[model samples]
Target: MGGALVVYESMFGNTRAVAEAVATGMARVAPGDAVDVIEVGTAPALAAVDADLLVIGAPTHAFGLSRPTTRSDAAARTGTGVLSTTIGVREWLEHAGAPAALPADGATPARRGLPAAVFDTRVLRRNLPGHAADAIARRLRQLGLSLVTEPATFTVDGYTGPLLPGELDRARAWGEYLATLLRALPLLPEDAGATGARGRTETPGTGRSAPRTGRPASGTGPSAPGSPR
Candidate 1:
């Protein structure tokens, strides 16, 4: 809860900008908190995410996560450097393993249920059927990560464009809210360096889901092949 890692995939830099803004917001609330912002291309798999809080963002491609074809189309259209088409948040989560460290009994560490949140950049005008953010959130939950917020979106002007006005500010605000939420929650015994993995079961209500408000780019964002599990 004192450390946060933000991983994002961006072709036009919109999503990366949002990720920085969110990190800035988190810093405002917890000045001493550790925060790492990583781009998907250079980012390690999700299992390697070693923070108490994990925040992920990507451009909403087709309707969900970006696939090989969409990523290629984006790089070609933008003429900007793109990461490997085979790798993104979706692919990272797909093969993510269990936590690096566990309790002596080999039980899932109480901290294994790390708090997580997801966001995406999308076109404001075109309404998409699915969301990369939602897909990422669901995958994190499947990995036993706690959901600190629902899928959130920041708006972009068009396919490859400037972010909508004030979206960065909103993202900062969201980060601050996430920090406050993390602070108010009690840490698990193991999380506090206790001798064993002992704590109450963390159910859904323990984490707060943020409300939906905006969209991102239309064609330039990530689109999952299907709905989130």
Candidate 2:
């Protein structure tokens, strides 16, 4: 009966579309479970997060996550079409404080470090390097959130793109996969580490390695294209 929250940063709305699709897929798989999607600008603080699972998405800028300067550049390119200009995922994570300590009364806490997944939208080009998803995964790990899956990438036709065909479908499928995985795993204690109290690996069922650093292990891609808007 756990819920999920999907938080995203978008320049031209492609990432927002993917975030919604992911939530849609999760809802379809677990209709009775709560699934919420939110823009990163308005996302709750880390200490305020109340979900059993967390999903983050953003656009790839330069070679990684967007900085204020990059976001400003994107805003200039779009005029008024940019979805978020003030704060991107990178800044949000940078300011994220650790979760509030558990209640001292031994009562169940509102939430604990969660199982998280990350995805990014990038140009659909072969052998292209850099993934915001990878960087996001690393930061979430540093915050002690266990990754349920490797970072994922969705491709746009270009820089401010309409996502390539099937990318939304792929995102939805990934969301469903994540929901399934969460449902299959046993819930752990609030203070458990990435490996869970039972010593099971972070990615149960899936054989993917939950490496702390390096490039994302799996993804879909496309070259820079038109904006979804």
Candidate 3:
């Protein structure tokens, strides 16, 4: 295989560790494929650059996705304002000028149409919030990426989680599986190198509308769409 990328956002470092395990699994299964793991905040904005697969993961926050920082209307225990919608932390950042902030990064490598998957570590107060995973998978699929397991979930005891004992193994298993699957796909068309169309589609997690014509309106603030498949 040519290459693959794993982009992740983690709070307690468990998720980052899990990402490393996942990458190792990928390398194990696909000996020649290139795998790069980076924190979401530091990862160059990745869009249309194509890879054989991409796996996105994070921690669950208040029935949604987590972020390193937040702007909730009301203060929360995490120190960021709570975002009370279907939107997640990354989407919020997207609407919060993620593009202009990337003055130094060239177009990110695309992983369109590959076998993409998503996961999250959530406090087990409830079964596990699914939207965070769906939100990530939906973003990948909007680029026509294939999905594995409608995204998956990893668990822990409280809001700030260590993801139980074996979740990192699970993540690695997922990465290995995805890498094996990606071997079947062809290289991207030469033209699919730039960022894929930056518009929203009917995300499965929330039928919440994508930004009108690929752009968020002023003050709308990026939020995850409410629950859906």
Candidate 4:
């Protein structure tokens, strides 16, 4: 069996809602698998991640991933409900050191490069540019993790928003789609080699299997409205 961990950062809870919805969708499809949803502020170090899949989500700020300055600005707003004040996904990925090495006795396997997916929440607007998901996908690749799907976006009414109608349903559907892809791939054995095989997982959104050792999937851009806070 495989498990998934969803880590997210939110300002006014829109992204958190989407993250939970995605987790719910995955649970619905893979009822026997372990699915966890947690705020990025409380997430364990990347080296401590112990799952087959990693899903990350955040709100877009300044047309990209949020920074300490941007997060501060968001908190300064009059009526905002900031959820993460200290750390954001940007800092989390930046601080992810190399995976731990195998023990001298070689009994336990070193951490494998887990398959990953990313999503973001931003405001709905005509021709608005930029996605935190895009930046997130880049960082995941830089960390040597392959993407199981393109970056996803869920729309919000504004910077601080009640999510637009049916966005949660759409998020759930995307999550279900991701779980199906995870089900198609074979899980690594307890004693599998450290250099695990690639191309074992399906391409994002396509049912076809990826080529072995092929380049990680790249995002085409944001597919829907998302958060701007």
Q: Which candidate is the best by TM-score?
A: 2
TM-score of each: 0.74, 0.76, 0.61, 0.76
Clash pairs, candidate 4, are 121-226, 121-227, 122-226, 122-227, 123-226, 123-227
Best-performing candidate as measured by lDDT = 4
Model 1 C-alpha lDDT per residue in residues 122-152, reported as the tens digit of each score: 7765324666787876666556666654467
- Comparing 2 with 3 on lDDT, the higher-scoring candidate is 2
Model 2 segments more than 4 A misplaced: 98-112, 187-229
lDDT of each: 0.65, 0.69, 0.51, 0.70
Encode model 2's per-residue lDDT on 41-73: one tens digit a residue.
999876567787888999989989999899888
Better of 1 and 4 by TM-score: 4
**Tens digits of lDDT, candidate 3, 1-229:** 5677677776556567767887997899878778988676555445543565666777655556654444242225455432232434376336424333322233444433345656665654433334466566555545455553335556555554556666666666656655654553343232121122222233244322221111112212221122112
